[model samples]
Target: MAESCSEAGLAPPPELARLAEGLTDQARLDGVVGLRPGRGGRRAAVLILIEVGLDGPAILFLKRSRQLRHHAGQIAFPGGGVDPTDVDLVAAALREAEEETGLDRSGVTVLGVSPAAHVAVSGFDVSAVVGWWHAPSPVAAVDPREVETVRMIPVAELTEPRNRARVRHPSGYTGPAFRIDDWLIWGLTAHFVDGILELGGWARPWDESRTVEIPERYLTDRRDTSGDVNAH
Candidate 1:
């Protein structure tokens, strides 16, 4: 059974009730946690924004610009490091989403927050803020330098067995992955998506043994400029 952290008196839409109820700390969701020794304590947050579309519940994702120094050409949720002026992680998430994708903050209803997860590669403690797009407004990549595309992918397509697989990085790291057209969703982002599927009872049996290596194009030269590592 999923745990609940919903705001008092706010009822989530039926399509998201399960997820809202099941929402808990990322560690319980099987997300990456615990920082490596000697890592700094930087904080960040991401918005896991969902909406009920014609097909069903869909998630918002943005493709990072290939020109970025790190995590280039990768699909990620709209987010970034917490700003000092922001009241909390939730505000940082909404602000980042709005800046990256032109998301109308007024239309989003924050469900709750998933406890922070330690992203070792980036040395940041990141939180996932769940939200419902009850009244979605026009969204697009507001900056070509940071974001290249904005896509709303249906959960049905993501849960399909044919689109699910495991991905192996050259570092010997292997984890859940999802393939949509030519885009490969992997790393921490994929793990969160996988957890969401299971939490919402939207998961389907898939071949875990079927794995693919991270494509050369998606691999970054870590020796260069330091920036946010794979999707937050």
Candidate 2:
């Protein structure tokens, strides 16, 4: 079961109050990607850390090291598979965030957990643990072997029409994507971003026709003999 810090009188900051409230209902999240619990896949959790930024609310993301065997050089939330020591998904999310991004868990206030979404390529039932970075702290890629860079991207930039588009994979999968300079946010990460924008009323209309093929660099290790790609 998901834990709730709201009962402890820990409310999200004003900037995220609306989004925190919207996430309480599974239906609201379902609109994102029809989220639900996975039946048989391995379990994992990701921390969706939001903080007030100079322009507005921003989300933290990490670029995985290219040297890693899985999801190499991909942008992702700080998280991993649940460890045996983890008390629950929330604990696992916080622990992974701290390990991957040097995040100070003490500064985060858990709002709630979203319905789990299964990634077919990785075979992990991933749950998103939404939290507010009430007390911001300095963070960086702690280990070069696992993480290459840490970034806090403002939601405003993501919602900009020109920054939004659709991405088509070699597997014939097409989905929403966000462009941040050279980085292309797609796959499961982009789906979550799309949902968050809708939940927070931050989404803007963009040309869905503006579709692009997944970059070759990101697809190097993603494709198989059948021409299918992996989700990041």
Candidate 3:
């Protein structure tokens, strides 16, 4: 529950295995395509989730405000469209994390970078960046306009085998997830989350049948809720 995760969010979490050397053959989803034809310039950003001490390790996720134009009320990693002032994707990620979660960027270390993801739904060429929040703290509600709720989910729970769901869209690609509590960790977040789990040699084989039909309506809405377009 969000209530429980918040309580656990107050404590110090342990370090996850950031051993990147063994992940050479990791299953990576086809990342962003050519920054879009007239998609203007590249806006890179880092989306870092901290697994503070509570509940093993907690992933920092955001519930976007319903008033927002895209992906309203969906659970997502706290980063955004890259900015011109950003030094690189890492800087943009940290900067965006601070703006969205109220977590200070001073103590966190850049672990590694995941393959860049282009959300077919929202036209965002996003790079999922992983980090360890060395001095994690309770993130105050910073910009209320975009973020409605800032929450964390457990590392162990999210990595559990039982929550496995193999989602096959009308498209050919299939993805996996460990649905922890109320959060359905699927789509791009699930894909990259699995990549991180692979860095720990924790990849568990999941059934191709375990399913969740992402509605067709989600596509036409043009929201980044699923991060990819269902090629129906």
Candidate 4:
């Protein structure tokens, strides 16, 4: 099956099937929680957008524009603080995905939601709403002010040992990191992706000895929560 797809340049690799199956296991959902929200915390959610690419399973990520008041120039999942009119976390995630990436909900198959995680810098209790883009659609940075770029990153490439490293902040905080196709995936986004790869059994052995400190210029302007929380 993998060989035929590689030849045809159409179907995804066989691992995509395993990924879809792994995502639905109830036990796997428990491993995704991050920081916990504080009392009277703001609510938020993110869509773990998944799709089968020509090679294997892929994930969608967004680059926030430099103009944004919060998390400017950061790579993050499509999500935001909840709006007053939204009914729940899932709705908020879907709404933000549509607004940020021009994704139509009808083409997406929502698998399930993971436990809510907290973003202390943003003060949001975020839930990961895992979804499969069964019928993939054209997506872009619909709102230029919010999103700078939209990318569908192949899981196989991400698992490459050379592409993995650790990112350290000046505040002495350190965590898993990934550098793929010119984008540096770190902070909360890196942790979230790492958890999914582990639970889905797609993770590969990588050298953890290699570490890169986040640039002081990057940290100087953003919320100084590097020691307390991974800023989203």
TM-score of each: 0.87, 0.89, 0.73, 0.82
Q: What is the C-alpha lDDT profile of model 2 across 65-105, one tens digit per residue?
A: 88876567788888878899999989999998888887888
Candidate 1: residue 217 lDDT (0-100): 69
lDDT of 2: 0.78
Expressed as tens digits, the lDDT of each residue in 7-95 for candidate 4 is: 33443335555554655676665555543433455666788888876677899998888786555777788987678988777788888
Clashing pairs in 3: 12-53, 13-52, 13-53, 43-82, 46-93, 51-58
Q: Count the clashes in each prediction.
A: 0, 0, 6, 0
Please list all clashing residue pairs in model 2, or write none if there are none: none
Candidate 1 global TM-score: 0.87
Clashing pairs in 1: none
Worst 10 residues of 3 by lDDT: 29-38
Per residue, candidate 1 scores C-alpha lDDT tens digits across 1-232 of 1112243345777888878667744444543332222144577788888999777899999899998767778888888788899888889889989999988887777776765666666676677777888778999999999899999999999999999999877766677899999989987778778878887889999988998768776565354224453443
State which candidate, 1 or 3, has the greater lDDT: 1
lDDT of each: 0.76, 0.78, 0.57, 0.72
Winner by lDDT between candidate 4 and candidate 3 = 4
Ranked candidates, highest lDDT first: 2, 1, 4, 3
Off by over 4 Å in 3: 1-41, 52-55, 169-173, 215-232
For this target, which candidate reaches the highest TM-score against the unseen true structure? 2
Model 1, runs deviating above 4 Å: 1-10, 24-40, 221-232
Worst 10 residues of 4 by lDDT: 1-10
